[model samples]
Target: MSLPFNNTCRFNSVFAGVLCTAALSIAPVAFADDGSEASRERALVIVTSDSLETQSMAMILSRAMQEQGSDLHLLLCDGAGDLAVEGYASERTVAPRDIKPEGLLATMMNDGAKVDVCAIYLPNSEYEQDDLREGVGVAMPGPMAEMMRDPKIPVYTF
Candidate 1:
């Protein structure tokens, strides 16, 4: 079963690519005109995993988009789902900077970003609703469906 290269890196890259492709495939079919009001306030939907680098990047990107006046919605799933658990983000993934993903998530929340943990998180993980940090909510299918159907919003995965 041994491979010539690092399997972890290979798996991660392939997984990331698949996720990105799925996200892109669900893109809204319509878009607001260039000068329209809707075009001015675009929304960003981020589906993130538990990878430290991915979480950090998603948070950083979310913060940047927020600064640009975009509404941010973050969906935490799989390993990334752990970030929603209170006091769980203890490891700092980014080196030299000492910034933790949880901290960035909190900043996004403070900036009015909507943070949601996947609906199946509790059933699939060892966490109860109370274990989730304050302000983190269980993602509902209805709203997510709407977001995916909205052409004005851009969906990204990390």
Candidate 2:
């Protein structure tokens, strides 16, 4: 016997839910490959805020992103560029562990995150190349623009 109209709709909805759940479970494996890192996830994190709290949160999230296996790329601009400066430290510290944003930034860098200062950071600021941390580089607009436009990679700004 055929089900009533409402029952049929209910059955269809249940079927669709199960189908979606199954697809979601397999989606991550679909992006994996054999021992190649190029296929791993990528994300660009831009920090331009001047607020200590904002900078603190940005570094916190960047750490989480790195921990999750994303190839984290950091673009520091404006006041946030201070994070790349050697010996730079914020007056206040974030709670839980009292670590400053600058300290957290260093930790993230040591954890393999790629770091760059915006192209104008040098010309607009008194700090020179020697002032920047050892591995931090000035970003080239050409490559940065390309990465920002890529569909598979996401960009997060704070």
Alpha-carbon lDDT, every model: 0.80, 0.92
Q: Which regions of candidate 2 fall more than 4 Å away from where they truly are?
A: 1-35
- In the range 22-110, model 1's lDDT, one tens digit per residue, is 87776544442465445656665555566788788787887888788787888888888888889885565597677788888888898
* Candidate 2 TM-score over all chains jointly: 0.80
Candidate number with greatest lDDT: 2
Residue 42 of candidate 1: its Cα lDDT? 60
Candidate 2 lDDT, 1-158, residue by residue in tens: 45698899999999999999999999889855654569678999999998998999999999998888888899999999999999997998878778798888898889889999999998999899999998999999999999999998999999
lDDT (0-100) at residue 38 of candidate 2?
90
TM-score of each: 0.70, 0.80
Stretches of model 1 off by over 4 angstroms after superposition: 1-40
Q: How close to the true structure is residue 7 of candidate 2, measured as C-alpha lDDT? A: 95
The residue-level lDDT of candidate 2 at 41 comes to: 87
